[model samples]
Target chain A: MDILVCIKQVPDTKDIRLDPETNTLAREGVESIMNPFDRHALEEAVSLKEEHGGTVTALSMGPPQAETVLREALACGADNGVLISDRAFAGADTWATSYTLARAVETLGGFDLILCGKQAIDGDTAQVGPGLACRLDLPYVTCVQKTREVTADSIQVERMMDDGYDILRLPLPALLTVVKDINEPRVPSLKGKMKAKKAKIEALTAADIGAEKQFIGLAGSPTQVVNVFSPPPRGNRTMFSGTIEEQVSQLVEQLQPYL
Target chain B: MDYFLTEEQQMIVETARGITEEKIIPQRAELDEKNEFPTSILQDMAKADLFSIIVPEEFGGLGGGCLEIVLALEELARGCVGVATSFAASTLGIFPVLIAGSEELKERYLPDIAAGTKWAAFGLTESNAGSDASGIQTTAVLDGDEWVLNGTKQWITNGGEAKIYSIVALTDPSKGARGASIFVVEDGDPGFSYGKKENKMGIRSSATRELIMKDCRIPKNRLVGRRGTGFITVMKTLDVSRPGIAALGVGLGQAALDEAVPYAKQRVQFSRPIISFQAVLHILADMAIQIEAARAIVYAAARHIDSNPKNMSKASSMCKVFATDMAMKVTVDAVQVLGGYGYMKEYPVEKMMRDAKILQIYEGTNQIQRNVIGQELNKEYA
Candidate 1:
């Protein structure tokens, strides 16, 4: 089985502060990290390749700086990296992003499995994975918490729910949007890092992937960001001070009307 | 003159920084208080293949050398020198094996040590032989196919915890230093016992205990290199490893400066931030300059050891002495800059101060290092 993992580099949320005066995100000095969910996605793909002999290729669509994440993936045991970078791909919405990725997948002759994070931390939209699967005409499972089994023709997985989880079997060549519960990501090995340093990252442009100009980048996106602002603080907020019991009773008294 | 790091070297620094910042720094205080060996952190480092930085590829390593180890250690010590010491001391133990172990011994020991499945420790320091390795009283005598060892090695970093020990023992006492031989002793060997753990002033997170070898028996195959070649092997290993200690010093000095510069900026005194004061500014300047100079020399020495191993002894001692002394002064100045807060345990500088002290003492004290440099100078001038 050949596995493809789609990863993203997002601003570390821990360092992102809300500018109260401007009602906007203050991203100064924020370090970019591999999307936490995407790390689990990559870990699952690598583990699968390890258990069953196969090749794992990491795929990402971003600016030149995004190549860092791809190199990181290689260091974490990916055999190859495909960086889909182009100036024309800037300001792409989820729809265009998925279309571009799907085209890249087709350009690479597809794979037996495709894995992605359930959602990116920066944009909690959770639309690209399913959209890519739809464009490729393959079945996909979202919020996959566990992989029950994987074989040549099919894969069994547990899709997480609010209360419990649902066991589902999907045919091979399917897509998966994995949650963080899948597995612990391994640290990159030194040998893997040496290989990454020497390895030539295969770069592709929109034209190289045979993507139509009308269906890629900002020009192809349907949705636009009208405004970006932080939510205003709510009026009714209370601090529970005192011992645990007193705080609980005080909170109960305050919530009596709503209850 | 080219100070730029290779892409691979940059990656090593980045990777080590990530692990140290994310994993090691958070647990440092608690580990220090408990004086516990960083076993789990080592496991994490193993996962990152840090143990393989110095081992050869044929021995199941990344095939890196002194430069790579220096890169990783500097980043690691920046986070916590105690943790870095634990990591570096294992490499020190493996050095003798890598330098002189037979092919079969390398195959038996190097792979596991490189893979980080087992930790290794060097056993040269003793109660009576701190700087004078010629006085190492540990003795190993051949009895048929086996060698019996009886001695106590003191102040061994990773002594009780490590799985393998590279011990320097006198095989023929009459020949003095020339009679010394090194052996690889496994943890489970008969008559191998551990003494009381030493409570230390700095790098307390690393395990320091006495390795008591009472009638310890090992196969003759465990002998590293030819008989009576142990002292030279030890010297060469230290010559190669000195830069690692220098890198640790540079990292600690940098860590101290890291704390001071920010605190100086934010800390208000005399109705303004302390950084506005000329005194504070000059202190910061001196700290930065010293650390950079130390770092430059250390990097040069490490690269020289990797590329030109034959004549690195003087350069190695220069780096070790210069960097460690710089660390001691820089850390003390950092504490001074922070004033009361620096003295308090709430801040990291005090701990860094404590940690910086050991850098000057271990791996050949600054006094011994000066001796090496002076001796080299005499030989060159003569």
Candidate 2:
């Protein structure tokens, strides 16, 4: 089985700053880390590969610098890594991003499984994995909390819901969007690190993957950010001091006229 | 310039750091307060093959170089100095055997120690021979096929818990340092027992006890290196071990600085962040400079040992003296930066300060290191 984990490099949320002038993210010098959710997805993929005896390949679509995330994934025991990077892919909404990824997957030939985080922290748009599956015409599962079983033919996963979880068994060549509750990521071993350092990340462009020219970059994106701004300062709030009972009585008296 | 660590070294550091952060740091304070041996910490470290960092691969060891061991020690010490001390002492204890032991001895002992099933310790310092190692009075008498030993070793790290001990005993009464011979003393030897555990000011989680040997008997084959060469062997081992201690200091200091930077940025004084003030920034800048310099020197010394093992006594001692003292000062400043909060036990800098003090004292005191440096310089001139 060949397991493919799709990950993203996002600005660390803790380190993020906003540019008030342009109402855009200030990315300069902001440290970028592997998406926290994607780490769990990568861990799941690696664990499956370790237990089932297969190759784990990490795939990422971003700017050229995104290769660092792939290297990090490789360091965490991925057997191989691929970078799908191109300027034409910039400003892509979830729809275009998924289409671009599906094309890249097609170019990679056959894969037994595909895994991704439920969402990217920067965008918080949780549509790429399912949209990619739809485009590729494969079975898809979202918010997987645990993997009950995995075989060459099929996989059993526990999908998380608001109130409970559902265990679903899907055939191979399936796609999954995982939550952070799956498994702890393994630290890179000495051998794994050396391999990662030397491993050549095969870079693929939209043209390389045979992406339709119209379905790339801003031209392909349907939604646009018209404006982004911080919320305005709140009005002064009244204070209710003293004992809880006295405060409640005073508040009721004060509000009697409005009632 | 090979700026990157070797693949093996990087992996060891990564694995050791992960294990330390995940398993060791969370329990550090509790273990210290209880004076526990951190059995689970050792078990986890062993599971990660940390014990094999310096062991030859042929003997089931990691075959890692000194720099690799120092790197791993730095990460491990960042979590808990006591656990790091225990782990480092085990590596130190096994070095004499790994370097000079016969095939039979290495085969019999290295596997278990490397595998983490058995812990090893080096016993050299006596109550009277702290810096002056030649003053040791422990006697080893040849009795046909066995050697009978009698000695009391003080402040032995990992003392009571070690399964195997590399002991130095005087084989000839008149030859002073030249007469000292190294021997492997196994636990449960009829006359070998441990004395009281020392109540330490810091690194209390590490087991430090007196090693008592009253007419202990060991096979003649257990003699490490050749007779009358134990002093040199011990010195060589210290040359390797001191860098490890320096690395520990680096780790503690790094942790302190790491914690302090964020804290200074967040902690407000005079209606503004302390870090915004020039005075605080200068302190942080100085600390960063010292830490980087000390780490560079330590790594250079470790690499010198790995690349050229002939003679590195001066370099090793220099690293030990500089790195350890730098760590002590850096940790103290880290505490000062935190102010009242830093003085509390809840803050890590207090513990780091305490831990850093021992590094300066142990692995040869800064004063003793200077003495070694002076003597080595004289030898060059003479």
Candidate 3:
């Protein structure tokens, strides 16, 4: 089986800065780290590859610097790193990003499984994973907390919900957007780091992936961020401090409006 | 500060730093309070391949040298000197094996040590053999295919926890220093036993115990290298590890400074932040200056030992003396900077100060290192 893990490089949230003038992220000075959520996805992919014999390829779509995350993935046991980077792929929203990734996946050939984080920390818009799954027309599961089993033809996973979890068995060649509860990521080994340093990353451009000129980049995106700001603090708020049972009854009384 | 480390070197630092932050730092206070062993933290380090940094690549390691060990130790000591001491001492034990063990012995043990499955320890400093290692009373006698060892090894780091020990024993007491040999003693050997764990003033999380060998018997092949070269191997091991101890000094000093700066900035005394006061500010300045200087020399000494193995005594002793002394000063001053709060257990500087003292005392005391350096100078000038 060939497992593909999609990762995104985002600013280290601890040192985030927002450009006041443009209300956009201050990317120039921010340290870039692999998205925390994506680390779980990558870890899961590597773990799967380790348990069952397979090749794990780390796939990323961004600027050339994004190759660092790919390298980091390799150091954490990924067998290959494929970076789909091109200047033309800039300013892409989730829709355009997913389209470009799908095209890149198609160009890279077939994979038995594709894993992705539920959302990127910066964007927080989770459309890409499901959108990519829709584009590839594969059975997909979101917020997978655990993998019960993985066989040649099928995979059983526990999908997390607000109240409980659901067990779902999907056929092979499926897509999964995993949650942090899935696994803990490992620090890279010395041999893995050495291998990462020496390994050649296969870089693909938009043209290389056969992405259409109209359906890619910022121009192709239908949605745009009009403004970004913290909403003003609401004035009317009640603080509830008591034991759980007392707090719940108080909350119920306060919420006893239309009901 | 910018040592222009290669990418892989930076990765080692980053990984060690990650382990320090995520693993050691959080548990350091608890470990110190209880004088508990840091087995879980050590295992976390093992998982991160921290143990493999110094072991040769042929034995499932990264084939790094003194510099790599220094880099990792600096980061680790910054988090918890106790944890770092346990880690560095294990390497001290491994050095004898690497330097003197036969190929068959290396093959038998190096892989496991490299993989962090089995821990190693060096036993050179006995109660009587503090400065003059020749004073140790341990003796090993050849009996058929086995060598029987007797006497106790004092202050043995990783004593009971470690599986392998490279201990010095006199094979021919008449020849004095030249009469001794090094041998590998397994933990479960017939007469090998661990004594009471010592309650130390600092680095309390690290285990310090005694190895009591009462007619301990081991196969003759367990002998490390040729007979009568045990002290020679011991010197080489210290030559490699003194720089590591120096790096630990730099790390501990950096940690003290890390604790002090934030306190100085926020500590409002005399109607203003204490940092605004010249007296308080200058201490910070001196701390930074000395730490950087020590760090520069430690890095240089480590690289020197890596590239120049035979004649590292001068460089090694210089660093071990300077860095460790610098740590003692900085950590004490860090406590001074914190003033009343610094002396309190709520702050880490008091602990840092305590940890700093051992860096100068152990791994060859500063005075002894100065003596070694002076002796080297005499040899050069003669």
Candidate 4:
């Protein structure tokens, strides 16, 4: 089986700060890490490759610095890496980003499986995985909690639901968006790190992939962010301070307004 | 000029964190309560190639740098400070040998340690010599073809369980600290025994005992470095080990803060989450600042040791002093944030506080660290 895992390089959320003036993410001097959810997806892909005997390729679409995530993926056991980066790809919304990624995947040739995280923490718009699948016209599964079985013809997975879970089988050449419930990613071994340091990532631009310029970035994006603001402060809460019985009476009195 | 950790260092942290969370944390309280030596955990750590961390790959080890070891210790401490303490001490005890031992000694000893088949202990302090190691009365007299060691080493981490010991004894009683010598004594040597285990306030899971040596005989070949170099070796070893201890402190502190942040967010005090209160938020913010500062110093010390081993004593001392004290304060504040629930043993912050206290006391007291910094500063002025 041939696997392609899409990962994103994100700011370490613990230190992430927003620019109040422009409603943009502050990236200066901020440390970048592979998105935590994407780590699970990469782990799943590596595990599948380990069990079934195949090559795993990590692909990402971002700035030139996005190669960091590919190197990280390689260190974590991916056999090959590709970086889709270009200034023309800036300011991409989910639709345009997925469209460009779908074309890039086509340029990279065929694969048995394509894996991605359920959502990126920075955006949280979980549309890319399914959108890419729609563009590729392939069977796609989202919120995959576990991979039950995989073969050349089809794959079975446990998909997470609101109440419980559902197991589904999709044909080969499927796309999957995984949750944190997937397998824990393995740390790179010393040998794996040395290999990653030496591995060359195949870099592609929008034009290199023969992507239509109109459907590439901000100009091609259908949705635009008009405004972003923090939510308003909540109303003050009443405190009931006293002994248990007195507090109960106070709580009941406060609840009377809602009732 | 990369300011962040190398890829290998990052991998080491990840691997160490995984092993620690999965294997060590669950057994921490049990091991402490039972006064059990974590032989199984040690075995698992060995399986994860932890023992080979500091040993050079040419010598059949992973060749991890000081930063890597610090990272591993940080993760391990997050699981259990005591277990991390013991594991780190073993590495500490063996470093002098790896650094200054003869080729024959290195070949004979390092392989077993690297393989995790044997554990090592450093014997420097005695009943009378806690911070003032130069005051130790342990004596090693050169006799014919062997050295006769007679003394008691107190508060020795991994004391009773270690198979190998690097002991510092007075070789020339007339020369004070200059007279000290380091010797390698294998376990089960004649007249070598261990006292009862120590009952401690924290890090109780790690075995700490008094090593008693009476006429303990070892071949002259076991003499490490020169006759009067033990004091220097011990001090140098501490320079490396202190960062590890600081890293442990930082990890424990972060664990406390990590727990407190979420707890404050979810815990309701008066119809709203405690985190919504300015006082609580301020405390959390302060704790975060302290932890980050401690982390910076700790990593800086590790980097100093790796980049320039000759001038790291001051950096290491500073890291140890600041990080440990920060841990004590942060853990206590974590307990405060939890209110009455924090005092209960059911909450991890209490244990974390208990564990944090030792960092201020061990690997040389914060006062001693201050002295080191002062002396280094004065030397620069002079």
Q: What TM-score fits each model? A: 0.87, 0.78, 0.91, 0.64
Better of 3 and 4 by lDDT: 3
Recovered fraction of real interface contacts per model: 0.67, 0.33, 0.37, 0.07
| Interface DockQ of each model | 0.53, 0.23, 0.40, 0.10
Q: Which is the leading candidate under TM-score?
A: 3
Q: What is the lDDT of residue A219 in candidate 1?
A: 94
| Count of clashes in candidate 3 | 0
lDDT, residue A147, model 3: 88
For candidate 1, what is the interface RMSD? 1.5
CAPRI-wise, candidate 3 is: acceptable
**Model 2 over residues A211-243: C-alpha lDDT tens digits?**
987887788989889898778899987899999
lDDT, candidate 4, A1-259, per-residue tens: 9999999998988897778998788899899989888999998998898899899999999998899889888877899999999888889999999999999999997899999999998899999999999999999999999999777799999999999999999999999999998775555544556677899999998888989999989888999898777668999988778799999998888789999
**What ranges in model 2 sit over 4 Å off?**
A19-22, A136-140, A149-173, A207-210, A214-216, A232-259, B1-80, B103-199, B204-223, B258-311, B377-382
How many pairs in model 4 have backbone atoms within 3 A of each other, for residues 3 or more apart or on separate chains, i.e. clashes? 0
lDDT of 3 by residue, A57-151 (tens): 99999999999999999988899999999888998998899999999989887799999999999989988999999999999999999988889
* Interface RMSD for candidates 1 onward, in order: 1.5, 3.2, 1.6, 3.7
Number of clashes recorded per candidate: 0, 1, 0, 0
Off by over 4 Å in 1: A11-33, A85-90, A106-112, A133-174, A179-184, A203-215, A230-259, B307-311, B377-382
DockQ of 3: 0.40
Report the Cα RMSD per candidate. 4.1, 5.6, 3.9, 8.2
